[model samples]
Target: MPASALEGIDESTWVDVIQKMDEVYSQLIDDEIELEKKNAELEQSQQFIFSVLSAMSDVLLVCNERGVIEETNAALCELVGRTDAELHGTSLYELLADPLSVERARTVLGNTNPARRGEGLELNLFDAQRQSVPVDANCTPRVAASGRRVGTVFVARPTAEIKRAYHELRSAHEALKRAQQQLLHSEKMASLGRLVAGVAHELNNPISFVLGNVHALSRYSNRLRAYLAAVHAGEPAEQLQALRGKLRIDHILDDLPSLIEGTLEGAQRTADIVNSLKRFSAMDPEDRIPVDLNEVIKRAIHWIGKGAVPDFEMRWQPGPPLMVMGSAGQLQQVLMNLLQNAQDATAAHGKADKLVSIETEVVENCVRLHLRDNGPGIAPEHLSHVFDPFFTTKPVGKGTGLGLSISYGIVEHHGGVLSVCNQIDAGAEFLLELPLAH
Candidate 1:
């Protein structure tokens, strides 16, 4: 073969080599373009996920199998008083105030032995100050791409307001207790005053009669003495005997017994006034078993204190063991009325004398309790109608006027009575009568 012909014969090899190089270059370019597109898509997806997490206001946290924080949103920063960078990698145990909180959340997430127990759990968290804060927490076990449990995702919200609601309820309860106390005190005072005043007035008559008899006895005794003196002076027998007869000395002497009885009766009448007062106001209601009047009274005051009434000035007079038979509840109602009245009366008027006085004493199987207020005295005209139903000195809508009336009814039901009085000084008073325990 000629050399020129051979050279020309290499055309096939050159074409093949050129064709191979072009094909390889084309493939490389295509692969590079596909790789660039994939990288861009991945970056966009990452940006979208980050944006979603950062926009959320609620705290979201992710932890690894070891309970170490792997990811935290912007919200975690505000929740823990730290930045997301600071929160990441932090152990869940370190982030939580109580390790049990996390345990409880695990249970709620159905990670416990029985699994699938419930949805979520409410937890009370203690702040640095150890104050309770209500929080609702939920979690779910996280799975890796391989379908193995990796960690958990937790979301939480502060429940401080819920705890505040509970506290408010407790406060309301205390207020109720104070109100109950005041009502009982008022009732007792009102009932006692009425009965005592009536009985005292009635006893005056007997006392007067007894006093009259005593005066007569003394006069007769004087005459008998005079007659005897004449005899001792050695007067003529007829004259001495005449004097004795005219003086009625024998009759006078014989009448001494009657005279003494009259005096005793009069003194007894006076005593009856006080005794009746004691009986009327004594703390011995027929409806009740024995109870400590003092303790009951205290409860009444506490109940009333919760209202607009300011701190009351309470004066308790210690007396002999003041146990009485009365319905504690009803009696408490009465006392509540009286105490509220006193506080209200004083409240508008600036709590004059600034004192609420309580006294107890025992007399004749009854206990006498005096509930006195150093408030402005009741007007003379109003005193008579104070106990009347629907009669109130307070402005309209301020009171029902039934406070005293209902108290009166309660006392009556217990076989006792209630009343009020104007003190000689500037104040009003109420007395209660109840039966003494045998």
Candidate 2:
């Protein structure tokens, strides 16, 4: 009967039906292959996402609109001491440590405005031990493909870690400041050390003068004592007169005043030198006061000249006091550094007439001091870097290169300006300008 029924159907029709069936089967096979490829790609994408979530250090949680936990990363699971399966259906509010946090979370999750979504909202969450842990959290609305807000994604970082980072940064800043101060002090000491020879020579002159005056006074004292003893002995008037004449009492009397004056002058000079040295070597004070620039320059020159070569000369005219506002000690240091650098520059060139000439002028509201040296001027290329730390043309051991840099800083701190330029005539000239003290 099946064969009779097949005979009733045309062979061409059967052929057509077979062809249609084959086409349908082939289409099914192609569709199955396509589906398998898509599944492989989906698995790869899921694995990539999982790897990323596991690698993140911050807590991540995804919840539905009802606040039911739909997904969580490894960090959240480890923090709460729960597996993904155990936490899947749990309410987000149940993980909060306090009612306040729960209420805040509710407000944040309920917000519909994307721009007003939770940003840096601090919340306390229950940890593995049920202890509250503070975190800075950001919550963003997670929209589905249909453009509907389906849930909220929470990303948070522990506050303790942020606070620790801030503490470390502040500590580093303080340490850096201390190190800078130490470096400044060390450089000052080095500069002082370099002037030892000059300082000793400066003290020598006053000390030697004092010693000589003391010796003369000692001799005069002896003569006066002998003359007084003769008078007290009740010797005959003529004999006393003879002793007085022999002792040259009138001459001694004439010289005594001069000798005493000389001694006091020498002692005072010595005291001044010692005081200057003490001020120079001591740390600069923070207080600013009116300082006589002319006096400071004179002292710097006097000290630096004492140990310089005999031919080295500084030409400066005593003028009415140029008063400025600054730390006297710091100003002295700047002057000394300038003078020393000039002397070195001249000496290095072996100029026969090594001279440094300083001139001062009163500009509006400021006093400008120009120091010029008769030696090789600064090179065009090196002019800009003269005040840079550790930049020097001198031999490695000959200079520390911090003198000008420190001086520049000191001048700026004093509300002044220090600059240099190659003089057109012969050498480099440094100009220092300071505001006049009211």
Candidate 3:
């Protein structure tokens, strides 16, 4: 029967049948190859996604509309002490540490809107040891390709970790602030060191006057004691008068008052100088007080002038008291820095008549102090960087370069502005402006 069936089919028909079968087989082979390639790509994608989820530090969960856990990352699995198989198909609410968290989770997961996103919800969950761990959780609605809401995706970070990070950041900030303050104090002390010579000279005048007055008073005391002893010895009045004339008692009595007054003045002056030095050398207090800029300028000039060369002169006509709110020591430091810089500039230029002139005026609600020097003007390229830290025109050991920089910062802290420029004629002028105290 099979031979009879084959005999009815012609050879060409059989050839066509064999060729169609070969074509069909070839097509099937190609399809199989394409399917293998697609399978390989899918496997690679799954591995990549798994690796990403495993590497993430935050806890991740994917749940269906019923709050049934469908997928979870390694972090979540490890946190709850469960395997992927155990976590799958479990109710997400079962892992919540409290009823409040369960209610919150239900509310977040129940929202079916595709555009809804829940963020920064503090939820507590049970860890492997059944201990509560607070987390900052974010929930976003998961949507299907057909635009239908299917489930929710949750990502959470531990609050303890975030708090630790914030604490560390605050500590670093405080440390940096302390370091900056120390640097400022170091620069201030360095400036004070440069004024030692001037301070010594300033102290010498008052101290020497006081000593001279004290010596004279001692001699007068001895003469008075001798005269009194003679009078008390019951000597005759003529003899006592002769003794008084010999000892110059009348002159001593007249000069005693003047000597005492001068001594007191000298002592007071010394005390004032010492107090100024103490204020300048001490750390600036945070409290601000009304300071007279004119007085500060005068003191700065007096101190800096004592150390200047014999030919150097500072001309200042203080008009009135310009009251500003700031640390007096800081303002004095700024003025001293300006004056010193002026003196240095003039001396460097080899000016025979070295002079620094200062003027103060009220402009609007601010006080402006202008200090000008007679010297070679600042270089065009150097003017812009004069207030930069570690920028100086003097020789290596002659300057620290922090003077103007620190002074600039001090003025700024006192609500002031300090700037420098080359005078049109020939010199450098510094302009300082500070707000007036109410």
Off by over 4 Å in 3: 171-205, 227-438
Residue 153 lDDT, candidate 3, scale 0-100: 87
TM-score of every model? 0.37, 0.63, 0.60
Q: All candidates' lDDT scores?
A: 0.72, 0.85, 0.86
Candidate 3 residue-wise lDDT, 407-430, digit = tens: 888888787899988888989999
Looking at model 2, residue 33 earns an lDDT score of: 100
Give the per-residue lDDT of model 1 (tens digit) for 54-73: 88876677887677888888
| Angstrom error at residue 301, model 1 | 48
TM-score sort, best first? 2, 3, 1
Model 2 TM-score on a 0 to 1 scale: 0.63
What C-alpha lDDT does candidate 2 achieve relative to the native structure? 0.85
Candidate achieving the largest TM-score: 2
TM-score, candidate 3, is 0.60
RMSD of 2: 9.2
Tens-place lDDT per residue, model 2, 284-325, is 445878899999998888878677553578899979989998
Lowest summed lDDT across 10 adjacent residues in model 1 is found at 109-118
Give the RMSD in angstroms, all C-alphas superposed, for model 1: 19.9
- Candidate 3 weakest lDDT stretch, 10 residues: 276-285
Q: How many residue pairs clash per model? A: 55, 0, 0
